[model samples]
Target: MKQNSLRATVRARLSGLHDAEARVAHVVLDQGAQLVHLSVSDVARLAGTSASTVVRSCRRLGFGGYQELKIAAAREAPPEPRDELDPLTATVRAAQEALGGLPATLSRTDLSSAAEALSGADRVLMAATGLSGAIAVDAAYRLRALGLPVDLPPDPLTAHLAAELLPQRSVCLAISHSGATRTTVETARRARAAGAKVVTITSYASSPLAEESTWVLLGGGQDLVFGMEAVASRLAHLTIVDTLSMILLGLGGGRSERAVSASAEVTADHSY
Candidate 1:
């Protein structure tokens, strides 16, 4: 039978149930989420009935027992009138689903190479501009907190200039949503030309920025579809940055101790 028809059957059988069982049935129809999540005891509490009464209610409504009733009700339940999510909640839920699929988009070999280069680099120079520049600033602080020497140039022009002078074996970590940002790309190019390994986080794997880098991390952030990158892309990039930071910390020993020592010492005064 159709799901709606199945639920209708339950309601049709409701009128003949004993009074206590009818009360439990009313609670089931009124609170759909309860049918899916609440236990017999919980439903009993909500309906002001005994747990045994709740089970009998399910049997009268054509279920073998409470668990069967829950499964049948959950599978056949109609959308409740009050079922709605506000904008902020809806966005976070969408982002959560997208982030769960991130591992498939990112390449393991590329990630391993990027981590090794970052761990061994003489220093890391990160280049970005516009909104992505803010991500770079935050990422630099995170890497620095791990005891790594990281630099984020103050502007695109400065980034290009700084990239030009990076020492061999250094890493240039580029942050760009489009991967086509001219100044950011040029900075990565200059870093590569200087023999620094260029590691990139970008939304497109086919972008020019990906072409110049030793390793590229792909993040097809949803915000890119709107022609300008913002919230969704930032979260994707931040997730990647945070994962890398945790990996670096796991290597342990030198600089990781900065968490308890030098870095903490400096920031401790600002907190309270």
Candidate 2:
């Protein structure tokens, strides 16, 4: 018999759960298909929570018991055999699913705070390296469109120097998917040491970049579409930039409208 899917429903309720139940939920959510076969005790050991906690969490999800949870999980598991879809369809579906989870994972309050920080900063220096550097540049342009003072240099050394020179009320926002990018992390650290606020846009909340940040804006959803260079991460970062831009615009009043209009007029003649 078919059972209602609980994976999505359970994840949505994770924050409302008790610590022990939440831990068990994280294990189940992270393990996904693998959990379908793991015994309750096995999951307890992996989540570092007790088997009773797992059972309780399952019950909270409306399951009659752990066995019911496993049964439902198996029923809702991804289509058997990984290669069920053609290559193109699989790629598109993967990207879609990764992007689709953003709405649930991202925090509106955190994003709003980040936007305010950027909008109210004395100066803004955005930093990243390699692929993420491109994202930094894009964010700089988007912020600049609102007439906000934004700087993003392609050179890592120059970017580092800019961060080190940031004064009070200034901000250095670093973009990194892994939060472990060495140059970006160091740049953020130097900026914070220089008396500037440091903001990090990353996927991991506990990463080094996040640790160095005064505020963190999560990109929402995992960026496993293709690893570090995954296009999905870039999309996530861009979404964050766009969200901040809109918030800043709303807070800017008439001034931001004028800036955007002026930018559009200037570029209008250059476009086909």
Candidate 3:
């Protein structure tokens, strides 16, 4: 097959993997085909586990050993042929599949809880880093357009400090594709510590950030072959943000409509 079944296989076996094995699996899963590039030791260091755990995790996924797993990764990452689908085509297909599967991955109960929390929150603090930072900023802007109180901290320290001050009725929206980002996870922890409801948007269901979240809005369908671990699907994250924004706007009544109109009009003055 052009696209290997390794990712699917690892995901299927995720819960059954022991803690160290799960950590190793996360490393493998997050890295995508890039897992073929790393030595067992490198993966172990990244996953914060031993090389033996990495070997065991691969074996648990039904591979004979780590080399077998790497071979599977290599097969999935062969160079594109001139007659075959291009990089863009592959990416589009993956995204289409991911979007198609989004409904199955997202929980209706969690969506309701997240929407209700944001709509009624006293404050909404957004925390993210790297590319996820941009998503948080966009979300903050949209939330503010509805006259909802939202804060987007500029950096990790500010996010940490701001999260600590979130009132009991506040909501902290944490976005991270891997869900293991240290600063983002820490920020969510601090927000929960202050009694705010933490909502996480992440691909990894069992990430540290999810552990810190009161509501986990898990989303995935992103597969950028080269950037599987480094950069996930921007469209997928934005879709989740849009979904939540729509919910808040839908439930906010006539006042929210006016706020959106006013916000648009104010911005239109600067445009043509």
User: Number of the top candidate by TM-score?
Assistant: 2
> Model 3, range 128-243, lDDT digits (tens) per residue?
99888888888999899987998898889999999888889999999988788999999999999999999998775677888899988866654455575333345667888999
Clashes of 1: 0
Q: What is the lDDT, from 0 to 100, of the residue 140 in candidate 2?
A: 88
Clashing pairs in 2: none
- Write the residue-wise lDDT of candidate 1 on 1-272 in tens digits: 23433333444345456788879978887765347778889899988999999998888776788887777666554543322766566566446533543664567788777887887788899989888888898989988888787888888888888888999979999998778899999999999999999999876655778889999886644332344335666777888898787777776466587663777888987898
Name the runs in model 2 displaced over 4 angstroms.
1-39, 45-81, 220-229
Point out where model 1 deviates above 4 Å. 1-86, 223-229
lDDT value for candidate 1? Answer: 0.75
lDDT accuracy of residue 69 in candidate 1: 72
Top lDDT model? 3
Model 2 Cα lDDT, one tens digit per residue, 97-178: 4455455455788888878888888899988987788888888888888978888876879888998788789989899877
Ranking by TM-score: 2, 3, 1
Poorest 10 consecutive residues by lDDT, candidate 3? 75-84
Q: Give the lDDT of residue 92 in candidate 2.
A: 59
lDDT computed for candidate 3 = 0.79
What TM-score do all the candidates reach, one by one?
0.65, 0.75, 0.72
lDDT ranking, best first: 3, 1, 2
